[model samples]
Target: MTTHERSKAPAVDGAVLIIDLLASSAFPLTLSEICEKTGLPAASGHRIINALLEHQMVALNTSRKKSYCIGAKIFQVASTIYSKQSIIPFFYPIAEILKNEIHRPIFLSVPIGNTVVVVSKLESSLNATFNLHIGQTMPLHSSASGKAILSMFNAKEQLNYLAGQKKTSSHFSELLPKIKADLERAKRLGYAVSQGDIGQYVSCIAAPILNLRNEPIAAISTAVSNEFLTHQEARDFSKKLIQAARQLSSRIV
Candidate 1:
């Protein structure tokens, strides 16, 4: 064995291999699949996975039989890394300006694995029943912020995220086809819209903040009471959001 290989702890290496495998997969994998893919012995793989499960490093996919995916702890760590990026520090001032101009609650969200998590919000004067807080998770294919981010992903990446949904409800599962269609439209329009996809009587319009490579690093969105925003008002909000996104993207190196 090479020096690095000789120094490795077998159990730790196995655990890491399993983690890497799970991280790379779009959908969850069964224990047998994990072992088969990682070349780990069945017994060792099971034990390592159980240990990861106990520590919240891996989670069971209840939607799929005996399958596993990266857990909440991984997402937490990813969010921490995202918070330290240069883009995050620059977000608040831009979002604040957008919120003032639009007169709606503004949200900043970053992708944490396959989902988007809200990292900041600028509260609006309107007493809208719905409010998004920092650390709140949103569906990749549903919410405006999520959709905006998704729109920037390549087709395969977008489909992988969509296919990996936990399918919390049959209604959401049934909407997958439509959601895919909406993502395409979002790509063309340079923004995304959500009508009650998250909260009752709530609507959001969002645009993706891209990095130098033109990949979406995050999204900025405005939420308003659907009851109050007219079609023309929503259109105005979308234009403002797209502009803010472009401004923010320019700052990203």
Candidate 2:
């Protein structure tokens, strides 16, 4: 079988099956419960659980009676995967150039698991302004980086990502329709914008970065203090932002 086919193979081992069931549960389960759910006998389940716990793949809740859950090791593995797959190494120099050219903060963000995380940032050299740094995460519905990335997803994926997050206000219910309209607009305009949505005093413009498969793997954005950009300045800065994003995208897969 091809590597892709091998990667897609279903789980066969008892421990893996138990882990899958635990992942889908959304809540912790006890050892007995895991065995019950997987229809495994007690001795077999105990052995699998012991092995998993030894590797820190499964964790026992010390405060509860035999309660178990997925462990921090899973998150550690996820972080490693994200770090290795990151494009920040390729994008940072471009971000530095954009920051120098625009005199504003330039940020590179990727949708990691369920959150859009800033992996790299070039802060404005100007004496005073909003400060955004690496490792910050923004609301998927409110930030330009989030919108630019969201524009790349299909309707179902976009809706799924937005589900369950608290809206900015009761009026924020209107945001989904607005976001849909914005996505359409972004597709035509080649970039996205956030006007004081993430921060009352800051505005941003962003464009998507696509991978080898033409899937948007991330976004690059430039944010300026609202006071620093007049209406005409904002428009001009957006053009520059779009140009920078296009250049950055070309460097990626």
Candidate 3:
């Protein structure tokens, strides 16, 4: 007789909730199916679906029982998120290669405002790597993947970002110089590192995956136990990571 446990986070808008449902679904859903799952009323859901269809954000499966799924517009937009053109289709190959070369957990992160969202992750089968999941967000200044992208920003952009970070936490303001220095060094080195920045027992090394405009849209990183990370490992992995980033940047649209 008990209802399902509820989340503490505030509820999202109905339109956004519908979009999220469609994104999470593996297959197209009928109007009723979407409404039932999202708890949206049939009338409101229909109106939202029609609007989405008009904008090419959702497409109806006319051949089927009027089921709906993501549209070409969403696909076009997704093609350029964290990973260029398409996150998985473009990044998975490189992720596999990095996994083979580095023997550690590889993660792909996209910047969503001040935080980075984990889009795709390849968990290491060796020695139990970091237990992170897809859709998890990490702070821009507190994680290696985040730093890799942050370092790609121009001087003005970097300063503005540091100012924002400093605003969020006065404690980090004292370390702003060192943080900026680290990003500057990473730009020159073509890779970034997080040594006990996110946690004491874990560490990461990352490189930014850029676009045709030379702006970073996402980052790729390998995670491992702090004890396992060494100077030699970082150097070797960094070289490979830079190469991978360059290759991906060139190949993406």
Candidate 4:
């Protein structure tokens, strides 16, 4: 075979071997483990692992000693791509306006795997009581921001997702019916609400942000102290939250 043919052959095999190893449960593998799993021998596996590490496609877990895992570079690329396609920047002005109008903390959240992670937050200038830092993850069955995103999925999908959570609360089983009912109500009202679910004395209202294909990709929410809003006031804030979410969705698509 030609030199080009010989070079291409191992490259294809190495790529496939790397992918297979990554897909296995034996991840965060040491060099020995990777060699054994891929049948690539020590020297070959070392070269492959080094190449992946150099590209930041794989990472070393120094704390775990000799373990390797997926790297933050993947997420960095994903965040960059999503930001380019998202309406988040476009909706900042409107989110600020909503914060002023509702006099509450406003937040924008997007689904990352099984969790809803906060991407942006606007603090309430009026009270300054409740605050949510960006990058915080909320429970799907509890938080209004999470429910708004969960509402986009069907019942079976939602149940399957909840089942996969290792650390589910006992409250989840007791409140499943109520959670379903709330999701139904949210669908009709175009938003969702939560009271003291994630944090004591705090309440939130949220609505979904739909993508170009009309699928829910993210959510926007306003959070406040329970003392700040009465039942009726909370309901009204949910409406404003829906409006803001709709506005943001429109801009993205």
Candidate 5:
């Protein structure tokens, strides 16, 4: 890539370089070695490494003091991409069922790093429906589906994710506590709610699909226009959403 293009995409370029280097290597690399190989400055490599580590795309070998290697997330993604019928087939029908019941745009999503990616969606037919497409991603703190998945993360994972965010998030400390409270409430209610955080004039209700061990592997959500969402009605929809999520979780695990 040209210098100007690379400058415009520093984060993407640095991340791609680090992943390519680690994937091609037989052994883990030290922080200095990665910087040398990528020709990235020490500080630049450090920032890239922290971001990758938060996603579990790379893991630190603490025993070796700063050595890094591909983490389990790589394998998880590989299996999903390479394998046929990787959970989507089983989940979409459930999303359809929920949409028919709620008459809203239902979505299936999986948490990847600090965000959630839409894997499947059943679009609504209403004239004023909200829109969501498969493969779209949203930040964990901003979307209902994202927070539903985040509510299931352990304390350590949550801390690691928040700590790795880009430097532009100067007020993240002030924001994290509110997100934490939302997750805690979601955990108790078995669903999460978000108002226009991910979409303008849109409200969403989401619930986590749990694995056998009760960990959230993914989530299901319904996004609707704010005009249709009344206070009591939102809670009722949340309960129904949780019920649908639990049903899907059982079939998947």
Candidate 6:
């Protein structure tokens, strides 16, 4: 078999080189410092930095106005990487066990902006009307998995997320009170339940998978028929889900 040479782009290479320099620096680097270290032309470096800033790959330091550092987007990407690599591997067996016990579809999700994206899913054999797949994004206030993750956030963080929701959701103002109530109940119960909030004739129960700092890094949820959404059964499912979430979280490190 013949091996193929890799393609390269000078502009992309320079951007990566600039990111590396910023990442290795003890402090934010000024534009001149970045150009000097990367050996790129000043104009080209400035354009690259501006592009990075636009995409939130890099950010201006608040204290040092002209200096730049890594941005929140990079850390968000890194967290997703960490979750997929370190955490998801430990989730399958636990999810499989939960799926078997509850006879419902199980999903594993991680936060992205104000939403949660499904990273893994194990479907149930039962003919349930509800369905979810990998890469599907769910609203934080409407879905069990999203609520589970949100419930773990502090009041300030929760408020920030909800505030951002106003920009995209038309009924956000009206839904605010109910969403807050749901979050409080989720926090109190150590799990969240969405009764027909995600779809008709289906309900979901989820629990947050926390990191070492007790912050939610991911959530595990099971989607079941509305028939099982009754008080006693919902509590039962929540108890099992919370246990599985804790078990998976314990093995994350």
| Model 1 ranges with Cα > 4 A deviation | 1-82, 166-173
Please give the range of 10 consecutive residues that has the lowest summed lDDT in model 6: 1-10
Candidate order, TM-score descending = 3, 5, 6, 1, 4, 2
- Ranking under lDDT, best-scoring first? 6, 1, 5, 3, 4, 2
Model 3 per-residue lDDT tens digits across residues 91-208:
8888888888878878888898988888988877775856567877788877888889999988898888888888867698788887888888888999999887556788889999
TM-score of 6: 0.66
The estimated TM-scores of all candidates read 0.65, 0.62, 0.67, 0.65, 0.67, 0.66
Which regions of candidate 2 are displaced past 4 Å? 1-82, 127-129, 162-172
Tell me the tens digit of each residue's lDDT in model 5 across 1-253.
Answer: 3355475678889888888789879889998999888888999999989989999999997667779998879989967763543567777787777778878888888887778888777787864546577667788878899889888888898777778753437787788788889989988888899998657888888999888888888888887678878989889888889888888888764
Q: When superposed on Cα atoms, how far off is each prediction in RMSD?
A: 11.5, 10.3, 6.9, 10.5, 11.3, 13.7
Candidate of highest lDDT: 6
List model 4 lDDT by residue over 62-104, tens digit each: 7678988776766687688557645668668998999888887
Each candidate's number of clashing pairs is: 0, 0, 1, 0, 0, 0
Tens digit per residue, CA lDDT, model 2, 101-207: 87877888888765678787777868355656666777766778888888888878877776655342456566778877887777677788888865788888888
Compose the digit string of candidate 6's lDDT tens values, residues 146-250.
999999999899988998998767889998998999999999999998877667888888999998889998999988778656889889989899999999989
lDDT of 2: 0.75
Q: Model 4: which ten-residue window has the lowest total lDDT? A: 1-10
Off by over 4 Å in 6: 1-85, 127-129
Per-residue lDDT, model 1, residue 124, is 75
Which of the predicted structures, 2 or 3, would earn the higher lDDT when compared with the native? 3
lDDT of 1: 0.85
- Model 5 CA lDDT for position 206: 95
Clashes of 2: 0
